[model samples]
Target: MSIIGKCIGATVMAIAGASMAAGDPTGATASPQALALLGGLATAVSGNLAHEAYNKLGDKFGPLIFARYPEIDRNHHIIIALRLSHLDAVEAILRRFNESRSSDHDRERQEEAERVSELIKTYLREAKRFQGDTKGGRALEEREVLAALPKAFETALADRSGATPDVQAARHETEAQVLAELNRQIGSDLPPLFIRVFSGSESGQDGWYDLFVRAAASRLKDDEAFKSIWSAEQLSRIVHMLSLTAGKIDRVLDGQVIAAQDAERRHDEQIALQRRILETLSTEKGVPASELSPILERLLGHVDVPIADVPTVLANAVDGLLAKSKTLVAIHNDYPEIDRAINEARNKLKTLDIEGALTTIRSAQERQKELQKEQLRAEARLHFEEADILRPLYDHQGVIDALRRGIELDPEKYWQWCALGDEYVAIGERREALNTFNTALQVAQKFSGEREISVCYDRIGDMRQAGGDTAGALEAHQAGLEIARTLAERDPSNVDWQRDLSISHNKIGDIRKAGGDTAGALEAYQASLDIRKTLAER
Candidate 1:
């Protein structure tokens, strides 16, 4: 089996091995390719070769491979073998890729661990800074730790990533360690305010606002010396300022958390695309690396394209290949008779007959071009069929892009322009929507009939109303009503045009009412009611 094939088989086997160890049966039957790859791996040399194969697979597939097959013993064996083989370059690359793919939550766990360690160091430093002045230093030490306590608690409890059992345990361990040191250093010395704020069982209770409120209330009520130093008004001002500051801090933290989550989501999407590309390349049995490289490069480049556009972009690429294939088919049809002459020339070249060989070689070259063209045409047709199959799977943005392309291809199609305008409106790009509607209206004036012109004006009026331009909306509606009135007068039997005129009158009435012109509004509503009564009777 090929190296690529072996990688796929090994991946399946590795996953199956993990499942078996966990007392679960492999849920589905393995594919023939997977079985073959597995068989190849089993029959191959053990230690170095097996490890090298696994390393190459991991290098290509990244951390997702190890995550799926997380058997520690197997991982250890591979690492030992890799080291013995002295494949430092491969080892380093795989290590970097794996670390990059490891759960970001684990990294965040480590960060919390480091933060608590640093807090301990800082506390020790602060303790030593006032080593000899124990009487005065006690209050300063309590204040310093109180100020740092919120951050330490935040590190322990803030939602950094997925809080699995392991993550929770790690966080709890760090929180306990930090709290223990804090209690040991200043637990006895802390006032009732400090104990009330930080002694809660939950980490989130250590927030500065809660701490400030409790501390202030305690000092104001119990400490008569504290009361003599400050007025009630002064205390109220301090609490108010603290509340405002805490509120601002909470908003900034919320924004940062949201931005971080969005970044992580994008990163996961990119990793998924990479895994798909790797899996696809591994499964293609006989495709040469040279031929595959360009396809792989293009797929990698497209990883950054918005997910909605990927399907359409891929389909269009296939269409381009199909067009090239059609050109080849035409060439093949024009050169049907050159093959036999080329074969004869090749036979003469064996006898050192240079002139005959040259003539036959030229004929053969022409025939080869024709054959190549035929092959390309066949491949192109297959690609075209595949693209068609994938068309329905494209998303809303893909559909919009395709529609826009269609409009560009047939610029004179006023209806397509109108359709694109509507799509733009659906997506909330009001500026683009208005521009598209105006463009459609311009085209309608030259190539379309009065109904199309009336529809354009109606759509423009709606957009203006949505934008809060009541006067502009009224003007556009009036223009549409004028066209509708003309069309209705020209063809009295056209109910659609008459209905449109009534709609315009109602819209004008709404605008007049909103602008506080009750008399004008009443007249417009009366006109609309008259049209509706006439239509209802008909």
Candidate 2:
């Protein structure tokens, strides 16, 4: 824009800023609002003036003024820097000129240039182009043009300037067109991936989209198409990553719910188990055992529970029918055997085996049979208590079995796969354990549960090794290790990954040994051991 045009535009912006800053009754905070409005108006006016100058005086005239002034040449530099939307540059120029304290004319000129530079810089900064075919964007280096005004004004703004009209219009039109096209490209792209590829239960990611847009625009320095396509591609990657992340998050959330449910189930079972044992220990009329005691005892971890607190269902337990809360604080300490007897009596309660229990109790007095008799009494009592309490859980066998069955029915469900794998671990069933891990992996590949995926692969390697497919097992283990490595790199700060990586390395080492690659195996073991040591210290 011409020096005259900028002055006119600045005047209009100043008027608007003054009015708003005067405190209109609308209650909007005035300073920022005025600043914002002033910046916008100034940019618009400058744009119009530049367009006009491009049309009237040709591209080179009144567009610059004080830039050419010999004494004011430095201010022109400040002007251009400001035009480039660099406030720091403008401030820097002001500091240099203002501190010099030269003649009044120089100071006045410097101040005017600084004010103009500041307003333009502020607008350019606020007008950051984050999206469009322009990608990293192309802003008018308007400050550059204005900065030239001090020097160039002598010739360009002269009454009979030497520049031509056609040349000027062409330059302005082309530059404006490029900037507009870039923005257009960005707003038009990116919708297809947003809709089709993202389907997690909780999937609304506008902020992510915004970041992609900024990155895309940043890449568009040379060509519009490149930036536009770059943005679209980035958008796709972000969506895919988000989908994977969301799926993993859901798995954890689901697991938490299942954990709570399982704990509740166990606690209820324990209570039922204990109640039956209690009922069985009571004698035929109302008498308790003369010197009652059961050798076999089940102990849950200690808890800080209030003695007066009502029995509440616990969240986790063993032996489906044990009453952890009741047994802990509520039980009588003086008659400690009462607790043991009650537990022992439950095993035989369902069988109505009063005769057997009495005989077992008598045998406890004999030195040779003392421990044996107590063990028998305890087992018998447990069986009776378990029988009745087991009914409800057994009744839901269809669902439990269904889940169990599904674990095999589809190897892809990590929850199911992990379940069957755990069962195999308990029974020393290596073959089944290997099979279960395979099932786990099938489901895991479709999502981002790398922890379980690594587990499944490790098990597969183990199975393959047992079956004498040593090379194949080694390959599988290596693949698992590679997967862990990739996950760790992607999330560099995840501490748990250290352990996961270590375990994977150990598996790799073992696989290498089985394949007759002793050296490789040693390296793998060393790596795993090192990671393990680090984790231990942490």
In TM-score terms, which candidate is top? 1
Score every model by TM-score.
0.28, 0.25
Per-model lDDT: 0.50, 0.44
How many residue pairs clash in all the candidates, one count each? 0, 41
Candidate 2 TM-score, true structure as reference: 0.25
True-structure RMSD for candidate 1 = 30.5
Pairs clashing in candidate 1?
A: none
Q: Alpha carbon lDDT of residue 488, candidate 2?
A: 75
What are the RMSDs of all candidates, in order?
30.5, 29.8
Runs of candidate 2 exceeding 4 Å displacement:
1-402, 405-412, 424-433
Model 1 clash tally, residue pairs = 0
Worst 10 residues of 2 by lDDT: 148-157
